[model samples]
Target chain A: MHDYTMPFGPQHPSLKEPINLALELDGNYITGVKMRFGYVHRGVEKIFEGKDVQKVLYVAERVCGICSYAHSSACTRAMEGILGLEAPTRVKLLRTIVAELERLHSHILWAGFGLHEIGFQSMFMLFWRERERVLDILEAITGGRVHHNYNKLGSVRYDLPKGCEELMRKNIAELEENLPGLIKEFEKNSVVLARFKKVGKISRKDAITYGLVGPMARGSGVKSDIRKIDPYEAYDDIRFNEILEEGGDAYARAKVRLTELGESISIIKQCMSLLPPKPAEKWKWPPIKTGEGFGRVEAPRGEDFHYYEIEDNIVTRGKIRTPTLANIMILEKMLIGAEIGDTPVIVASFDPCIGCMERTMVIDKGKKNWFTESEFRRKFCD
Target chain B: MKRSPWISHYNASSCNGCDLEILACLTPRYDVERLGIVLRESPRHADILLVSGVVNMQNKDRLKRVYGQMAKDKYVIAIGACGISGGPFHEGWNMAGPVDKVIPVDMYVPGCPPRPESIINAIAKLLEGLE
Candidate 1:
């Protein structure tokens, strides 16, 4: 080891979010990785407290941008558990469809990001271009493309909007037509394979030890898909297979996600077939009673868990364990003993959401807002 | 289109909504590069600074340092409601304030996350005002 250390970012090209990592290098090879969080911390759990029960639903969705629907799903399910409300089958089906669509867009976004890191700009652009179809489908249903505020306590805010079902079917068919070719191109690409295969290989044992979830663990042939293991929101009613890869490397994880995209498409189809014309349950929310509830939903990254305590129609306490928190544990191990050239590829493989994980940070008290924009300009901008 | 405004993006504490939209504008469908606008990597090379999310204690100073790194002609655009006024997370215990609190903002593009079209419109407006 040369024992030289270099800082990767709090702001850098390869990283979409702000995260600083100190890397110990031996020439072009990285020997150690020390990750520092807290850049995107907003104290969401603290923010959830004392908020109205129905209102906290939106806050939970805001927890992770990629997994917004999953967080809202988890949050709603938990509050439903506390309220003892069993939403009708139709509601479950709608949620499942939206959730699967979210996975579609999210996986595509990840693919674009992964391709971008490997410098395959055309493929990156292609992936994102395809992603817009899924986003358009989502916008047709929820009225908002990215931040869909669709979920409510007892029922969704609205029934599947008129004509949205047709829109969904058309988009799904188009994506079904396009995905195989894209995945085939991705797998066959020499640059992608060379950069990804056997890079950051993890054993099933290490994945288990590190408690890796989502595609990270699934890549190692671990069948830990919460949708299959502990089905929620019509997941049990749907027919789909859990995609797994035995390779236990970056390519394997990416393969698992790409393969799962097909499976998610199937699940959404099943949900559409199962969705009834009538509203499943009314949108009536009862008075919030004092109780504790927990929910688990398989976010795109992994299993996202939410716990909430209600008192007199307001949240008294709340905690969220996002998938990124679990998946990021294996990142430091993956980076060790690897060439520094592969740093971005290896890090992007984890799809780390520091915003979700950094929700837990040491709050700095007495840090109050100071000065307006003009005041700051007068003092600082030169 | 005088000098091709090169843009840099920073996330203070976003949920990724606006950030994703900003990147979406660069894709084939929106393809802002065709208009000669490039998304640069370094703040030093950027002419326009796109800041997303609410400012918090951990990132407040980093935001300042990043703003300082950009050249004097930098145009700062606060993206999304969070960037403008902290949005739904204004009550966050760790939130320092909006983007404008710590740095001067030349434009405020509002939405929980403004669409890719909104971002494109912001860039056009920026160019028009620049001329």
Candidate 2:
């Protein structure tokens, strides 16, 4: 029984974010694991305390660069609900198109990283090469790739650019053609299947208890999707199945995302076909006297929820709960009693967005002076 | 082709916009390693320091210390609207403003969070200027 504590990160190559995981090892087996965050805090939620509702939308979007559009959409939807205003049909459809596009790009990006984590460079490269097409489409439409500030308070800031529909159709066609081959490769690939299957198993019961959402929960046979449950934007009109897997392992999660990519393509096609004849003339930019609202959207990772309170047209209180936040809890649960070697794969499998997780800033109330990940884990878990 | 460049990243109290994009470049999409650019976590191993976010008092000293630790001939490429200017956090009581106030910057990539392509382009431009 060799008792040694191994520090995983705050700055580790395997980790994408500044998360520190303290693993108490019993000779290569992780007997106990603790996860700590907040190394990249920017006080985003605190800043939203006293700002105009419109201005707060901008700040909320900046909460996470990868899921910026999702956050903005959630925030705007909440604000719209509070103001009792519905965006024009055209605006709603456009938002859905952008969101589904974001999903396509994000899922591909995550899949590439998951492959890279398991020492699969070729798969990583291939996935990213396909991702570039999505980025090009986004850049063509929104004039920016990652953080497209396209979602305004009532409607989108920019409408579809010239030949945008044709461009989307072409990209979608390419993805549709190439995706089956990639799926076949992923299915037949021993390396991917061996590492991912049954690696990070979380039962459906535990998933619900730990509050897991999106693909992570769905992978465990939990039928929970914000779009299906809540039905915001054009999601209500679109006909697509929520991809799910009974096995709650890393491979199941990966499969869920891979299948959803096809669903995303379908959703996009529906949006394109159902796209309104013309953009809205003037969207409802109603005033907010004083009220509170909640908005939730299904992001690439999971369900992203934004809570906001408006007073005199200013955002008095705003709090964001990203999918990563929910998924991190499940990560800790899944990591305990697991081998140390599977750390990176398990962590990357959830597609944990550090940008979203670092929103929680702990003040460290002078108990230890140094708030290590191990200590936080012990405090929270115990 | 000859210069083996070492790059360090600085998070001077940012919203993690530029930071993610910087990492994106290191990934397969842009793959900065193909251009002989290596992202070193420590400033001591760096030939170029990439700064992201607005400089605030809390992290200002840490930023200066990291910059000072780097070896000479080190270039600074400011990524994102927040790094070049204060961005959305421009006017706050406990703010120190942009990266230029603390350290000299060589290039600027301007976007709320500049896309990975833009960052790759900026790094390319930086390498060209270095040559």
Candidate 3:
């Protein structure tokens, strides 16, 4: 076997994010993996400097479009904590609703991508089609599917749109009814199980040592959901079980996501049922004077934390630690010793937001040319 | 209707908003392919070059190369707030400026990052212009 180096992305279909994973291989097996990120870095933190505390929400959300609301929520919560203010009950409920809705969309989207990576095109299409329902519900409520910016410092920007409850009920009911079928399809499919089951195993010890969070950690048998541990918003009000799998493989991660999708629907139903009556008084709070704060939210991928430094109501410094950042470390670990052919499946299992992961520079080795999709496709197919 | 344009997407220096929306337009929901628009990774294989993000000095040369590599009669659509103007990140020293400063833009779709529908509409207008 000859020693070969392969660059995985910056622009490859297998990689959802713009990361370049240079795998040094001896024949088909990966001996070593070099990871490079920042291809998608927009220098958002640098731009946040000197912006008003309120305005930083926009920049923060832009950090990861898939997890936009989670980032914004984290920022707002951090700011709220700094100002020594707690959001109104109604506002907290609304935030929880939006956050859970985001999780539904993100997880479904990931499931779709995972299917697609393994050549299950029909499953991919079906999952994305279903995800559209979540997007529509989000759009109906916040007027934007991806970047809602609905979470403001003190409260949300707008009240629930007309028919919002009915919409939630319809979607949640539909999702709940359909989830068993989807799970059955996944379980019965030998190819899916063969490809994913125990493909990328992350042990409990390694997961804890890495400090991984979200479904990735839970998949590895680590009960570390921020929602369960640090119950925020309506999470405390609703009774829901944290989905877990002990396999810590690709299949386990997928199963965790699939189960959470069902849980998210139930949580949404509870929210709709417990939604408070429309308050007469508009929610308002005094602006910040001088304070620094940190907020953590469980995004679909994992725990997303935002730290902010405010001086005189203006953001002096803002730093966001997206779940993908934490997950990326674990992904590199999973890639080691895996067959190069399983790269896409391994990469997709992390559900990496390349938009978030592409923050590293692509170092040119000058030996092998930049990786193209065709070359990758041929290699994988072969 | 006669000739659907071949589109190429380039990320200069952006927050990925415009890029995701552009992809959304290409997906089954918007299905820009129905209009004969296909997202080609290679610039040489495209008819309409979709540029996203603010032009930074590091990426300026690559942007120009991609633009220059396109076949004649190719259209350039500057999508999103960053490409149309300098956008929010325009004031930085490292930023080379807006897409217009480096290349002639055939169309501009504005939004902090334009929505998928807006991107579809921009493509429709560009196709109509080509006809």
Candidate 4:
């Protein structure tokens, strides 16, 4: 068969976000993959420069909706680190609760997408149905569902509303009750197992070499979860297991996320009980004089890091490194030898946030004499 | 409406807030399908182009292309704050403008990321306007 190039995206159904994948196909197998990003670049990093430390938090949260709370927390923590500001124990616990909730919702959302990619519509519905309860918990705590804007400079935006703990406890119980059955079905389903079991396999060494983070690394048995390694917020005070799998395939990645969902629930429950007496709102942010610091959080997809340099309350330089940016490069390796049919499944397995990953790209066609637009119009529009 | 409206979603330089909410709109809680709204993958078959996010330089042309591909008498619902007025990233060097500047938007659903119910209301209003 002749080698042919198939452009997969920019706007394709298989992709939940915009990403252009130039796939070199030899019959059913993909021989090469060229990725073009920046289809969704809103100039987030550029926008961060010269913004007030207070307002930058909102912009940070908007970096990616799935991990909005995490990004916001990371931004706040970065500012706090620079100013030597430490939030009270209760504020730390509250931040942890919201962050874990963000993790649960993001993981469940990805699971649903995974099921959808594999042609399991009913399973997708089931996953999302359970996810709504998680969203309810989020809505109860933070005002908005997706853009929670819950993180402030030194403390979170809101305290747990009345009965919020009981509500969370009840929701956690319901999720714990339902997740096992979902996992059992996912594991037993032959079609799901067939499509994902050994597909897009990555070795532990390769995962490290590719700089994979979050579940993508944990799936390959690399104990690289930043939460456990470098505990932040209330992570040091809380106890939770770092979920891992040794299979290093798409199935393993899914398993890691599913298991981590339970871990997130448990962490939230622990955080709720450990809440300190002082209200979170009482903690205030100190005036930013001049300093630089880095903050990192274990976001749903993986490690999310933010580094900033502030001079007189304005962020002179700010850098955010989201997990998808760390994990997306590995797709080039994973998709090289996979079948065309498995492209979407393998890509979805990474749970890539292309919106966060897109930087900038200019499509340069060079000096080649291609057919002009007028030539095409003259040929076809006559 | 004579037939179910098939909708196609386009994310033109969004932060994914509006995009995820659009996904949630289809899930069990919202179950937009009950409104005779089908989510189609291809732009050609879609009756309503559900656009989320601001129009950036790179995606502006792509968004316009997708809009042009839709059938005649189609409607465009610009969802989210970014879609309506470019929101926080309005001053970015890469952004061209909001959705309406590039394409003819019929209805606007405004939120940082509008709720699923809000999206449904926008759809209902669009249908009402169509009548």
- Compare the candidates by DockQ and give the number of the best one: 4
Give the per-residue Cα lDDT of candidate 4 at B22: 89
Cα lDDT, all candidates: 0.88, 0.81, 0.79, 0.87
Q: Which candidate number maximizes lDDT?
A: 1
Residues A234-341, candidate 4, lDDT per residue (tens digit)? 999888999989999999999999888888888988988888775625655577589888999888989999999899889887888889999988889889989999
lDDT of each residue in B31-121, candidate 1, tens digit only: 9999899999999999899999999888999999999999888789999999999998998867789999899999989998999999988
Q: Give one digit per residue, the lDDT tens place, for model 4 in B6-114.
A: 8999989898988888898899999989989989999999999999999988898899899999889889999999999999999876788999999999999989999
Candidate 1 lDDT by residue in tens digits, A210-311: 888899899998988999999898988778898889999899999999998999999988888877879633567566578998999899999999998998
Q: Against the hidden reference, what TM-scores do the models get?
A: 0.95, 0.89, 0.89, 0.95
Backbone clash pairs in model 1 (N, Cα, C under 3 Å; residues 3+ apart or in different chains), count: 0
The clash number for model 4 is: 0
Off by over 4 Å in 2: A365-382, B8-16, B23-34, B38-46, B54-73, B90-107, B124-131
Please identify model 3 stretches exceeding 4 Å from their true place. Answer: A357-382, B40-44, B55-73, B91-94, B101-104
lDDT of 3 by residue, A277-365 (tens): 87676777556589788999888888888888999988887777888788778777788889988999988888877656543333354
Interface RMSD for model 3 amounts to: 8.4
Where is model 2 chain A poorest over a 10-residue stretch in terms of lDDT? Answer: A373-382
DockQ of each: 0.54, 0.34, 0.22, 0.58
A254 in model 3: Cα distance from truth in Å? 1.0
Minimal lDDT window, size 10, model 3 chain A: A356-365
In angstroms, how far off is A111's CA in candidate 1?
0.8
- Model 1's CAPRI class? medium
